[model samples]
Target: MATGLILIFDKTHFSKYFVVPSTLGALLALAIPDLEGGAHDDIIYNGLNPNAVNNSKKYGINWGYDSHLFWEFLITHFLSLVLPFFLQIIQPKEEKITIKVLWKSIYLTFSVALFLFFFSWIIYAIVEKHGSPAQQISWNANWFYMGHKGISTLGELTKWPYNIISLTIIFFVLFWLVFVIKIYFEIYSFNLSYQNRKIRFFYIKRLKKTVFKENVIKSKH
Candidate 1:
């Protein structure tokens, strides 16, 4: 089984595309609000002649109890904390993915995440306390405003625990964004180097083609 797995990894482009994208995509999906409940409610209540209150109730999905949201929270936070270091490991040694670099990336990611989360709370508090639509609009224009609104609304409607979880989600998203920026720069550097050296470009092109061909072979096998 290990041999088969090794062959599969060696013979597929999974690492090139699936690894990074799937990891990042899962993280992003986890970060976003569970529109799944909304979707399910829409499907279930696909009828006419409902009253306003009933319609509202029908439209609402009990996100508070949804297992998926809990999973998303766990997955997102785990990925945000661990994926940067994981990425560093996967990168070529020549790429200089050092402990220092990994630490810096983690620090930046966590810092940004914390800043956005707290900032969101501050905005939420101000908007809710002020009780002015105009003020809310102004606050919404700010960068961390979404966190504020989400946290405030959830807190007002639900209990403290839920509100705290919501804030944690915001932090996860912020950290994920930082990781994305780091990956972008890494990819950009590779592309720049490839552009400058014909030999490098040749190797990259060959690598991609070989990987694709290997994937096809593996799929057939």
Candidate 2:
């Protein structure tokens, strides 16, 4: 096996692409209530008729027993963001991986996760207590609003500027997740190619040495 050399991390590049976008993505994911939100009682009681007694929008992720700060934020959400980091930071460069980056990455992940959750909770609490949405914090009024009127018309749910901003953020996060997955696969392929080249080079060197020894022996004979 080839030994890897210590190298400096590209902190600027990492922060710009990896950390910042991930942080923003995570924040948006956590803060924004899921689209599949509905009141607890709003269920399809009958196949033909639906009971809208709860006035449930009938969508959004069920923020059930696992919605506590510890469960949702650090344990669930924080660890989830760290999964891609493990795959992406595969040290494929061999020489370009450093302890500083490793430690800094862990630190940044923890800090950013905490920060996002804190903001999410703060916004959630304020919105809950306020009874009505003061401004368009979430992109879709139909998506995650707790109290007051749910989306009456399609226009209410999908407006102009807010919709653009919200959809952009959502798409960004989706692309970012896909990107992380792609990076992992690309690194895996690169590592395999690198190992094959190294093996070929080693074999060629050994073959040259053997040929040189053979020639020397024949000359002596």
Q: What's the lDDT for all of these models?
A: 0.44, 0.39
lDDT score, candidate 1: 0.44
lDDT (tens digit, per residue) of candidate 2 on 1-221: 00111113333234312433454445554664343433232233222133433424444334455556325544444543553354346643431223344345445544553454445455556666663432323412332212222322334543332443344445446544654554344333432235644643222123444444432343343
Q: List the residue pairs that clash in candidate 1.
A: none
Candidate 1 per-residue lDDT over residues 113-187, each given as its tens digit: 457657766776787687464455455422222344343333463223244455445555754565456544544
Query: TM-scores, in order shown?
Result: 0.32, 0.29
Measured by lDDT, the strongest candidate is 1
Extract clashing residue pairs from model 2: 35-60, 36-59, 36-60, 37-59, 37-60
Model 1 ranges with Cα > 4 A deviation = 1-32, 36-55, 58-96, 132-221
Best-performing candidate as measured by TM-score:
1
lDDT, model 2, position 130 = 63
Tell me the deviation in Å of residue 83 in model 2: 16
- TM value for model 1: 0.32
